[model samples]
Target: MVFKKFTNGCVNLVNKYLPDAFLFAIVLTIIVFLAGMGITQQTPMAMVKHWGTGFWSLLSFSMQMVLVLVLGTAMAKAPVFERLLTAIAMSAKTPGRAVVITAVVATVACWLNWGFGLIIGVLIAKEMAKRVKGVDYRLLIATGYAGMIVWHGGISGSIPLQIASGSAESLAQQTAGALTAQVPTSETIFAPFNLIICLLFLIFLPLVAHAMMPTKENTVTVDPRIFEEPPAPPAHKFTPAENFERNRVMWIITLALGYIYIVYNLVTTNFNLGLNIVNMIFLFVGLTLHGNLRRYIDALMASASTAGGIILQFPFYAGIMGMMTGVSAATGTSLAQVISNAFVSIATPVTFPLFTYLSAGIVNLFVPSGGGQWAVQGPIMMPAGVALGVKPAVTAMGIAWGDAWTNMIQPFWALPALGIAGLSARDIMGYCVIVLIMGGIITSAVFLLFGGMGWF
Candidate 1:
């Protein structure tokens, strides 16, 4: 009862104080800018230049993120996809069951692909909201976002995937030759400790979220009318172009041709999965399931509006990444590097991973990009860990968890899920604060125990 009171208090506080996500980004930008000037003593103009350089840097990445939402939402709109999701949602006959089921499914989906996980969670939540009475809609969306806390430990994780396949040269250069060889997936993603962590979250996060559900009087269920499905397009006689647009056979043939390359690449690349490949899978699956070009295009258009927040917000984050990592000519170190080095300076072997996790979580607030954070911290922490007798994979996983850990409170990544669920970040972030605290304790304990046991 006391714990529930504390959780409810957090929700009320965030709802009172949390601004819109875009404003949060702006405030964060100001904080980083001022911090950079104070910490590095770099001139404001120099910082502005760095910010401007990075403002457009995420154009490609931003598009990929946009497509993750657009494609996943589109795919979910297909009749088959709707039926499958509805069947899964129907199992949750009660409010607690709805929350638990959403968290578990979202966790597994996020493990496969973070982008897909984000959309699927809310879509399932929406379905459950329609069928289940007394489920808190805000908490359901928050549960969807909470699933992302395990993504960095999963198959599609960027840091592990980068090291396993392509970042060796860059990593070597960044670490100043202290590390050279690639760290394989066997040592990172599929490693015993990482798998154990993923399994625990898969088991426990749902329970934690189930416990956080508001009471019947406090619950905020969504209006079912908000999720009314769009009507099917009317049939008509067609011109040549129109006939091509409606042709299912043409789409199937094209999908078949795309899959050949996809299969060939997976075979050649030893089944390595990357963000681009995940997007391709979403695209092909969405196209095939929607049955024809016209309907698929319609699905895509319907889902496109959900991407506005992501589109408007990511470049600012990219610029924030730039400011966080950009070096000062006077100080000769970036703010991110300085923040990392502070934690590294006080570390013993057992505490190295713990401090690294804590520091990564802090740095993640300012530089939320996993790849970007790794670029800044990986080179610094990995080398320091090696000198202290910790393994490279352990150090890398610490950084990965740090990136995923703090995301429970960060509204940037929550944009997609929030947009789909028709809720503001403030509506859901209180439950996420509980998730952030619970997840922090879990991951930190794991790192400490394993670090002490020399289990890594």
Candidate 2:
């Protein structure tokens, strides 16, 4: 079909032109640094210093992201995980169905918990790649990530949940109360308008991806050898040390400890499903299913390659984040301030939600974290929303989706899925660009429709 040809053409073009993830990060770093120099009065040396100070700023976050890829890949290697994934993959009778199923399952899982959704999406899509003959490896991964595109609309959506739980102290402090105190989940995450937008993406993204499957002759399937499982660690003549390494009791004990911790947190604190907790869950799940220390270590080694791009490049992005969003020790003007102020100047009261969404999308390129981005943009956009007579909750959701929308192209979020799938951003970003365009249309239409209804 013409559609398939166009999509395939796009893919080939990307494969020809797109660079590796590390280079992509470097290029983004250069661009942001230049922008910082142009937009702010900071000296080049000062900007470089800021970049240096900020390079390690994302260490904790980098570790969290690394774990998601590392542990998630290790978890997928377990015999139990692989079997479960294979069983589900087996249900898909054709290549297109595999892509569709992965997308739907990923979207729904992401709706419940973003981390769970993330790991599950990549794991399942990898399974499908291993099991489904002739599935385009890149398209399968793209479909999995497409499911993640809906995470901002899900229960774990950071900005909406923050506003819903009335814990937006950071925003309030920054904005001096330009944002209201609390706008319940009813007006944000669970809003009927938001739900309609979420539903459309959840249903349509997979179908669109399915439709984009390349012609039979042009389909690009990866070699099965790439996903082959590693051999279980060999046992020599019986010894106490070997027995200790091979025993399941230690694994079970460790698993029990993790479960106890999870229970204690859920009961005494709250359902703390942040990246750390989720990473812990992935760790324990990997350990338990892997069955023993030696086997787990082997599985870990097998998937360790997946984390290289993420590990090498996160610091550069952190540096870029520093220059663009961090206040200069001298000049004081941030690139984020300039870009956001420009948008703020042009936005009308009634049209601000759409601007909020678009502006968030722009800032999201430099600042990828949902909470971090909200902190930077919320103060400015939220106050403006109120002045323009926009609903606080709607303003909040608009920013949320904007953050999610740009994620499709940002290599930051794609690291985990790529690590799992053994693909680079260049392999799938072309397809993701298509998804991003579609997502923008859907998000823009929803924002406009509600804006017209005076639902601001």
Q: Relative to the true structure, how large is the alpha-carbon lDDT of every model?
A: 0.89, 0.83
Off by over 4 Å in 2: 166-169, 233-235, 328-332
TM per prediction:
0.97, 0.94
lDDT of 1 at 62: 87
Best by TM-score: 1
Q: Write the per-residue lDDT of candidate 2 for residues 72-183, one digit (tens) a residue.
A: 8888878788889989999998998999999898899888888888889878888898888999888888888877788888888988877765555755775559754767
How many steric overlaps are in each model, in order? 0, 1
Instruction: Indicate the residue-level lDDT of 235 in model 2.
Output: 57
Q: Model 2's lDDT to the true fold?
A: 0.83
